[model samples]
Target chain A: MAFLQPLIFAIVTLTVFFLAFKKYRVIYANINLGKDEKIAGDSGTRFKNMMLLAFGQKKMFRNLTPAILHGFIYVAFLFTQIELIEIFIDGFTGIHRFFWYVLPLGGFYTALISFIEILSVLAFVGTIAFLARRNLLKVPRFHMDEMTGWPKLDGNLILFFELILLVGIFSMNTADMALADGKYGFAISGMLYPLIDGLGDTTLHIIERFGWWIHILMVFGFILYLPASKHLHIMLAFPNAYYGPLDGGANKGEIANMPRITEEIKLMMDPSAPMPEEDPNAEPERFGAKDVTDLSWKSLLDAYSCTECGRCSSACPANQTGKLLSPRKIMMDTRDRLEEKGAGLREHGADHDDGKSLFDYISTEELRACTTCNACVEECPVSINPVNIIMELRRYMILEESNSTEEWNLMFNNVETNGAVWKMPASDRTSWINELEAEAEAEDA
Target chain B: MSELMASGQEKEVEVLFWVGCAGSFDDRARRITKAFVKILHHCGVSFAILGQEEVCTGDPARRSGNEFLFQMQAITNIETLNAYGVKRIVTTCPHCFNTIKNEYPALGGTYEVIHHTTFLQGLINDGRLKLKDGGEFKGKKITYHDSCYLGRANGIYEAPRQLLELLDAELVEMKRCKSRGLCCGAGGAQMFKEEEEGKLRVNQERTKDIVESKASFVAAACPFCMTMMTDGIKEVEKQDEVQVMDLAEMVAKAQDLI
Candidate 1:
């Protein structure tokens, strides 16, 4: 019966993980379509960034204490898969010492098990610290606005899951140690073996079966919940870090020489002949991004992949200086807007036009408020480029609606007329150099 | 056009110091530009002025989402430089330096650009420049403002402070300075557009640190800093006591003692 339970649990867990993996793959494919261009940099730098950001979790180190604690948990979880496999095999056979043949360090198995138990304790403590920091400590700087759509029950669910895992680990080891009369490995469990010694073998077996079911269920639940929560970073972060833009390079690569609006309209008008106009329509067609389709696929990916960590908001100079702009909020808004649109699509079907797109949701003031500084991108743990979104919106505002700042219009005119922002007359540009005779002589020589 | 040097010959063209829009248009800033040029000449660099031939470098337009206009101006400026056969350019403005050196390449205008602080430091390093210690002016604690382009954007923070150090002035630092320096309200063409809604104007917030330092003078290396801080000082009503001066002007005053 014990063996049947674990085998069934394994099949269920694998099925759920496989389903989530498929869904995430589709989301990833849609996002890659939005990449502006291939980033240019030293290949070594890309490798280093991947190793540090993806593997090393470099960005998380911004919060030093939590970073270290989380690092221990991450490393321990990666290495402890051997323990998990052993537990699963033991569950199937109802024989705790079945893996003795595979134990290379026969006498040291107790020590290894003890070390894993200690690491699990450390991970539990670290998770508690993280929970306290987010909830009780209430770091206002990291708080997100409501529109960002953070899961409310996330903290409670994660904490409960950790507690369940700890209990499950301890109960299994304790039952095993009681059966062996402290002869087996698992020092911590050996200490607790006496407590469960008075219980009958049948009761001990029942406890072991219960622990196995709960632990397996928790793992499977976590896998299923991942795609629906900010915890999606567990899977998304690797690719996000790997494909991040190269540093010291153009924030966005070469601007695509998009066909002018006039040409597009002309093409539409004439099916056969090439249409040419000396001066196209008096009104310029929308040039910049006007809607969701206007956003590059990477932008849509950015929306879906946000962990809602608020690291971007923390790094934003504008946010620090008390601006309305929050890079985190921007990512959240994109995600929230998408969710709303998805709901609308489901309700009204694909052809539904409820007037709910980026145009109606994001205001001109909100768009213009962005300074196009890469602070948000620098701070984003998942490597979302909020600046690109703002730029695309600005392009829409400028080219299509001609709704840009009057100052820019005036500056453009000045440059066109007199070759500068100030529109200075073309006569007196060289007066300062006339005063420096040595400089004059250096020029003449 | 005859003022031009022949092609393939090393030209002794006067330093075509671009005063830039902020320097030439703002009154107090013009004083600093005049003083800066005067000091460069005093250091014996033969430089000719490109009076009307110099136009706006289109930095403001480019930054404000008007790249087309920026390109047009850049092209015109490049043509003017070609007409003058000018090879070397120096400016007190970090914006002009960044635009000319970094942005102009995209517009096919390539020229050697130097910020005045770096050029002045070169003069000091070579012993061509000297400053007479003023023995510390009374009621004057000076903190330097790191202009974004000169400091964070281009990494020219130390040269200006080095020049100040040579003047024997007390160099007080703001809470955030150098690589993590705060942006003056002038970058990204914030100078040209209406201030975006925020808790405080970025310039005013930065100027508060200058006030908090109780520094009599806020020394800066860029024309934008000079203009923005001066206006910011007035906005905060600290203009009567606290003053904003370019590093060159401060160096010029110290030079008078020498």
Candidate 2:
């Protein structure tokens, strides 16, 4: 039985790790399928931004209630993971509560456990409130159009998953505190111990073991579930914020990098500038993004990092005004198409063309619906810029596809010939001043 | 000052005041341009117009996703300004202000550009332009609509508000002000495009907010917002009760420059 236990533990741990690692490799490979373009700007500023916005949840605080609840749950889960590591070690060693001696920082261990206990209970309450807000209360923010179907199911399932973990944790603590004379903080769970107190010592030990295995197994399940879920933000938010376009700020019209495009245009315009050696045999350079591979790696990272929180869509002026554009849908659509492309590459190997892209999922009407007001970029707590994606697609539509509205085509013509949106010639620019001068002279007369 | 450029004479000034497309051509916005021009002369500040030398800043081109056209316009204007050794510029349009101030630097056209509201506020601060005590706008209920480029893009909420404060009118605020200020449906090159199909036009919704505010005098800082709000009011049939005036027009009124 002892040997069987170690064997089972090894198989389960190795299998979960292998599955999660395989998915991680696939995600990494798929992200690199995007074209190489550096997310330029000062690294120090980007780091500061990551710390302030992603880690600190600065944008989330705009709505205090959800921010507090979300923050509570985040911190609680982070702290509980420490206990998880301890449990994992216990599983491998065939020992129980090994942390009791391993974490022997004298009375400080009790304090630490006490703190974790309080957090666990708070996290429980927080998750319940969050679930109620989503399912029962139907908070408007969580009820976006793209949020239906799997996205909706994923939300509820994750909360239920977290609740299961919390139950196991509290039950284990309660069983442990009861079985032993008690040292670790069990204030909340200790109250529930009386109901199970009548069980035999063997039964009590079995129950504790049951709780321990359930908690650890659920954690393993969560790890495997991450890459396919919005919960991937748990591991991705930091890197996504760090890798974000440096100047796309929380204030004003701070937008994404067009440095490459800027340089390209400068080279094309400046006659004195040296041009790149033309490769006649190679394919012509694409004007703008058409496929997932045309976008930068950072944008791919952004799609993967999206938490599907709907902050971007909700804050979008176009979306608010009943336009087709929804920033959340943009990110979700990008991710969906990328995943499909990734599957194609996996099945066929070597950057296979699937004859489709983000455009396949996202409509032109939706793309053009964006106002580029940047409210979406500013509102994102994770620093995702749906406007950047929208702009790139728009750039493609205009430069490559020549697919623009009649008004835009006219404006383009005016800009090309008259150097303005209006057909007024360069000479006519001063016509307003001429009118002002005439009025002043008439007044004098 | 404008005639100096119009006369094809070489001129030098600390600031080259740019009257944008709307201010140059639109009848209502022309009033704003004239008011600002009068204030410039009243203050005895050295400023000149680009006159024929001036071209569009290509803001609409850029926003409308025509980068090639935008670059063409930007480079041409840059060449003209550089040839004349133009340094500082002030514009009455926030779209022009934003494109020139933010986008131009990347295109190698760098200049110290100031919005007219900020310029007017500076002049008031410098005691160059004086306002009448208990001016024509005195004790009136006035609310300001923030143009997106001016408020959110450039963070110039204070300058426009301070321009209004120079009047004796009571400054009222809408529920959505400052960073949360809504767009007036004319931004992002939507000025030239047909309105998207929706339950309500963006201007109508914005007008609803203004109507709910109950301020008779609606002060605006951008020509786009002025037009949109005017149309908004006309749609709601509040043309008799509500009057939309530019910040420059309001200031010029207070100073009796016109």
DockQ scores for all predicted structures: 0.27, 0.50
Off by over 4 Å in 1: A59-101, A106-116, A144-216, A248-286, A296-305, A315-317, A337-356, A423-445, B1-10, B13-16, B46-50, B78-89, B110-112, B130-141, B155-170
B139-186 in candidate 2: lDDT tens per residue?
Answer: 898999988888767777898887677787888998777766777888
lDDT of 2 by residue, A362-399 (tens): 88888776666666776788878787777778778887
Q: Report the Cα lDDT for residue A212, model 1.
A: 63
The residue pairs in collision within model 2 are none
Candidate 1 yields a Cα-based lDDT of 0.68
Runs with alpha carbons beyond 4 Å of true place in candidate 2:
A2-6, A245-274, A441-445, B1-12, B166-169
**Per-candidate TM vs. native?**
0.80, 0.93
Q: List the lowest-lDDT window of 10 residues for candidate 1 chain A.
A: A248-257
**Model 1 lDDT at residue B4:** 24
